[model samples]
Target: MIFKAIFSGFGGQGVLMMGTSLAHGAMSNGYHVTFLPSYGAEIRGGTANCTVAIADEEIASPVASEPDYLVVMNAPSLFSFQNKVAAKGVIFLNSSIISERSSRSDVQAYAVPCGDIAQDLGNTRVANIIMMGAFIKKSGIVTPDIYLKSLESIMGGRKKGVAEINRKAFAAGFDYVKD
Candidate 1:
């Protein structure tokens, strides 16, 4: 089965990183993966988005016309993309920044306080990773083990303590999903 997910937030919110890491993790899981990061002129604090697609076969498009999953880290991103989610899709919203909620009944929606969770975890920067965990665990798009490996590789060779916190964020997110 093919899985398509869209992640959106302000530029500095690690949207691109999340998409890339998801793609990498999916690839590690023996799936063909593609990631496309969207751009905005204002950069920091400006809108940003990324599309990640994973499939056992070749992917038709990197941009998701109808995503199986939508992770919205802010209100505007939610407003812009909520309508594009497939009827039976899963939407994971960042409750800390998204004041608006989807009215669609067909899609499975979960608003996780990722930002708040990250804050409690001592670093709000890892909020996107937290949401990624929820996305993976709930959607089953990629295994948490693969996700953690990808995350470690993404962190590069330096930066002590970051990997641990990020791993915790991912674990928290993964564990939060309703089984």
Candidate 2:
């Protein structure tokens, strides 16, 4: 099985980190994965995005012109990448800051209030993690336990309380989406 995903948002929204985490989780799950990150000139507010490809076998390339999944953390990201999603693909959007919905009808779109959820969790920086939780739940690319373990491993050596808040944020997002 093969899965390709694109994560996009403003530079400071942790878009690349989200893709990196997903790639790491998939790799730990024994999948061949590739992560490609891109950003505008400005670091903080400029546009940022990444593509992650996961498969059971070797992947030929990292670029995804049309991905099976797309996660947009902002309205501009939605507008920028919505058309690039493959038909019947899945889209996870941040509804807290994005007022509009995807115009495409060929794909499934999920509205997640990542910003509001993160704010409620007392850490706006974890908005990406919140989105990642929801995406992992819906996609089922990797088990939650495996994903969390990979996340903890990647985030090791951070300040205290970081893992706890991230766990809460991930759970909040995972619970937000229904089966």
TM-score of each: 0.95, 0.97
Give the root-mean-square deviation of each candidate in angstroms: 1.2, 1.1
Question: Local error of candidate 1 at 140, Å?
Answer: 1.0
- Candidate 1 per-residue lDDT over residues 1-179, each given as its tens digit: 88888988888888889899989988888999999988546656788999999999999888899999998888999999999999999889999877778988999999999989999999989998999889888877777888889889878885879889988999888877778
Assess each prediction's global lDDT (C-alpha) against the native. 0.88, 0.93
Off by over 4 Å in 1: none
Q: What digit string (tens of lDDT, one per residue) describes model 2 on residues 1-179?
A: 78999999988899898998899999999999999988446656778999999999999999998899999998999999999999999999999999999999999999999999999988899999999899999999999999988889999899869888988999999999999
Model 1 weakest lDDT span, ten residues long: 37-46
